[model samples]
Target: MTMTMTKLPRDLVEEILSRVPVKSIRAVRSTCKNWNLITKYERFANKHIDKATASERDKEFLVIAGDYLFSLNLNETHSRKFDLSINHRGISIAREHSDRTVFIAQAFLSQGLLLCVWRNVIDNRSRLLVWNPYWGKNKWIECPMTYCLYEWFAFGYDKSSGRHKILRFSSNNGDRYMEIYDLSSDSWRTLDAASDINTIKYMESGLSLKGNTYWYAIDYEKEDFNISLSSVKEEKLAVLFSPRDRFVIDIWVTNKTDPDAVSWSYFFKVETTQHLSGFLFENFLIDEEKKVIVIFDIYGGANNAYTISGETGHFRKVDLRQSPYKRPYRLVGCYIPSSVQI
Candidate 1:
């Protein structure tokens, strides 16, 4: 008599793979043809996302320090340098290049992946890279320069299409333009949405939550009463949509990704305590499970971090002196390290 191995059913295999860590799923797919097919299935992706979100874990913060990237604890007391190999333009490059080390300018987190806008240390040429830290893998996307003056970028994942997108806005000679890149197609297209908010012109990093992207902006012109009477009246109606008189930070959400029908909405606003005049809101991240919003602010030359209750509107500053590094860390995104291979 001889013993034989039995193969599990496809559905049973899928159920098991969906529950596994996202970073490990890529390897799981390689085990067999059936496993590979199941892992790439859309239903499997959705199930994996649900499992990943439902799991409870420590919140990790992504911070930029000089030419390196760091993942810090939410309490700001401990940090570990991320040592994954990073490459540009599909060419593997060593991070040890001190004279021409690459730096992340803008970054956003989607699911378990980190999307970054990086600049060359020598020539300052900008490019996009999507990195799966747990798996130590990244893919580079060439960024085409559309505007010569100023440019801003935002990253989001479109659940409907199962695609990642980068929104680029540039201004030249006071004229603003918008373009979008679809990772699936590996191409860029112009966005013709009629937007006059003037806030997207300067957004450095966008927050991607639940397949939607958001930017934090302050409507200063409307809040200032000393401006021209005609302009003040025009902005009065807009200000009413936001919180009154307080230090209001407007939340703008991306509504559509369709090039022909792209749009946005002023989703919500948060009013902070008074004396926020000199403070500049740099970046923010949301803890959906805990219902907490962490916003980073810059005052003078120091770091000002706050954790606010999403429901109560109460907030308090987070002390960062306990950390070893004294310099302000630019909080760009949130990172959840998993073994999910991309």
Candidate 2:
């Protein structure tokens, strides 16, 4: 007696389907009406995303190199790799700015949704984009004239309202005014957060944990800040600290993280190479189980990615020039897609 494919239990079917690549999920949905319906359920989508993200063999990250965006998977050899970019998401998102070459100037990940400021080559005009790559969906936001030079933007969600928001403020040298963009209303409003608020720049690590943004509060009492804060597994906050005077980098994680309360515990430390002196950018990802950390940085106009082992303290570096484009790499961290499309 032969068992038929249709005879497979629903649980088994879902388990198999969840492993399907997100880009190919649409095709899976098109296989049949029942399969299509299964993929549509909120539970199924979340399960698929979690399973795909958790698998070390299948895990991949989004990196923004010069003039292009690429996907990275550390489990594979350093040759050719899995790649998709803003241009591949389809034509409509960048339709208005067709004349200008599109490059992701800024990338911030919040609850898996990537908020990008796509910079155009024609005249350096900027466009705000919110993308849900898993579903192949995107939204282009209209910016108000109030947006200024040296402005930093963050993507976050309001748990109370169940709505997504963008925080915009001046950095470096500008006005004290803060503004926010609401996706529900498709409008911008003033946000009087702090006049003295100094935020992380585009080149710095911008960690969005549990659908919210976080930044280090300046300690007037302390002198040096040698740590970079990022999200580990998206369940906890991890900070990698490298003192200028030391050759070791330490990892710390906070189990309880919130705007009101956070306490960090030391994870471990690893020895670094002399080439690893630069600050870790917003584009690094940590593998907790493997005791490995893959980091990216652009220093002195050169692009390089490094991996440091917490278990053995071994160091290795990969040049971004190895990419097909041979362009400089401006590494942005992994892109985790949120269920919310906007």
Candidate 3:
């Protein structure tokens, strides 16, 4: 008996296509011209994102492991060490640069696409490329200048223009310069990013949430706050400020994030009992609904995610890394699958 999808409504067909894995996107598109047209819409990407989240797809991290680009599923066992594979020419543009000296220094994922910066150690040169791992689509961008050591890269979309953009900024010599590369226009424009007075010198763990970029940083003139840069999502602000002394821990949140004026509402406070190092805050998430803070153990290399309860002040470590990782990997960020084109 032969099956037919011709009778199904377009919405039904879309729902089915959204359920299909992003890895098989090529095959799905080739199966039917209608399917190709449906998948091209932005709404279909949104539907696919919803389907993935609803299905409990393990949160993935797109990592640059030495010369290889690997995906590590944070929630699964064994796969944390990476069972997934990548064999695409787009990846090769960054992974296997003809110069040989050039290597993928950093990567950021937005809407199922990856913005990669290929660094050449010998010449101190950089190459920027926007790549879709799922579709094997690659767009190379000319780097106006070499990305310095302190300069960081972030990938986000412009809501108004509906274009994917890359932001590269660094606060070097007490001054900051921000440059944005627009994927649609294929151009680079500099933004008068910051002044010396408000410049952030020590910044790390930059995260892009809801088209706005946030980072965890330290000011030499001010105090430091321990917060989860990874667990940031939503319109409301959520933060974990467990000072270095670690006597009392608390969660503060607010509805407004206005630069001029904003106030934080007290969420919960947890008294300290167990000894958790500063590294625990490296890659963390605030379980707002559950009132728990999950911290990825990067220091121990034990492949554990430390989940701590706010009320009980108790925590448990779940081992996610199955094998010993030899190469030191710099975190790009949470890898979210998107059907959106680059």
* Maximum-TM-score candidate: 2
Kindly list the per-residue Cα lDDT of model 1 for residues 10-73, writing each as its tens digit.
7777787778865455577677787776766667777776786566433455665444455544
lDDT, candidate 3, 1-342, per-residue tens: 665787788999898898886546667888888888888787987887677655535344555545556554423224222122222211234455565587776666566677777777886767787887665678888776634556677777877776888887655565567888888788889997563324442344355555555554456566755655443333454666767766556777765665455467777887767555445564555545546666556665554556667666665665545433434444555556666676
Using lDDT, give the best candidate's number: 2
292 Cα displacement, candidate 2 (Å):
1.0
lDDT of 2 at 227: 64
Off by over 4 Å in 2: 1-16, 26-44, 50-56, 76-103, 119-125, 171-174, 199-205, 217-226, 279-282, 334-337
Indicate whether candidate 2 or candidate 3 has the larger TM-score.
2
Task: List, residue by residue over 1-342, the lDDT tens digit for candidate 2.
Answer: 887657889888888898887657768988899898888777889998887776665555666554455566655234322122222332233435444387666667776776777765665456788877666677888666653555566778888877889887654345566778898889999865774455333345356777677766545556354666666666788777776677777888897987789998888888655645564544466767666777766666566677766776766676665556445554455555556655
TM-score of each: 0.56, 0.77, 0.70
Of 1 and 2, which scores higher on lDDT? 2
After superposition, candidate 3 runs with Cα above 4 Å error: 1-13, 20-46, 50-94, 97-113, 132-136, 146-149, 170-176, 192-194, 197-203, 221-228, 234-237, 247-249, 258-263, 278-280, 300-303, 323-339
Instruction: State the number of backbone clashes in model 1.
Output: 6
